[model samples]
Target: MTNSIIKSLSLPAPEEIEVAIRGQRALATYLSTRLETQKIAIQDADNNTHQIELPTSALTLLMTILGELAAGNAVQIVPVHAELTTQEAANILNVSRPHLVKLLEDGALPFHKTGRHRRVLFADLMKFKDQRDTNSQKAMQELSDLSQEIGLY
Candidate 1:
């Protein structure tokens, strides 16, 4: 996606932001206490209205994304099968190109070559990121436990 589109998605209109923040909490409550089936209504400028049913899982994701945008955090939605260039993959991972290359070589992340350039599947990148995050959380928890046992925390 272009930077402009990303920037726009990262922010909501002033009124929209307020609504989104409220919606985030409201959606969570509904998901927790009410039914999982939900429908959303859209109204066009001409006053034509349409309604669509959304799975609870999808609604949860939408609520979370909206909340993030309301808080001025950037969010990007990439199709699972999308192919990304080495640099694009690096940017997504917040790492340098060379580091991403190393991960690819180490089999920590998988990639395929198109001519001289390497391309990573969006799904594979996300898998690697999820595992890395889980590992980091585990390590932090271990450290915290050790510190507490040693009377350092």
Candidate 2:
């Protein structure tokens, strides 16, 4: 039998969160509290920047999530399409864009160009990422064995 979801744990509207935190704009205060309790990080462009020391956009996004939480709705969000440029895909893969372009050119991942713009599918990104993760695990095991044989720190 499927477990029934509790109403107390749900996400709400981003816009509503924005309105709720409008006046003081204490994004860090609000987010730190939520993040400390929840093992979730806000994937936001604004949160990546700190010169201003405030994540207005992230705040808005979180507000919506908090509102949903208050409303007792459970949801998990993911991208429908990768819709990323070569540079963006490289960033997602933590690799150089030139390398990603070469992979695309070599047919490693399915991608298409619209005029001059190239876009990669999210599914392809996920597949490549899984492969990379698996390879990393294999390499780590090999290195650990080598380290033990050599008695290297």
Query: Which prediction has the highest TM-score against the true structure?
Result: 1
TM-score of each: 0.72, 0.47
Backbone clashes in candidate 2 total 11
Q: Each model's C-alpha lDDT?
A: 0.79, 0.64
> Candidate 1: where are CA atoms >4 Å away?
1-10, 22-39, 53-57
Candidate 2 vs. true structure, TM-score = 0.47
lDDT of 1 by residue, 65-100 (tens): 877877966677777888888788888789999999
Give the clash count for each candidate: 0, 11
lDDT of 2 by residue, 36-83 (tens): 233333445666632334445555566665555445555443364636
Best by lDDT: 1
lDDT of 2: 0.64
> After best superposition, candidate 2 residue 43: deviation in angstroms?
26
Candidate 2 regions exceeding 4 Å error are 1-78
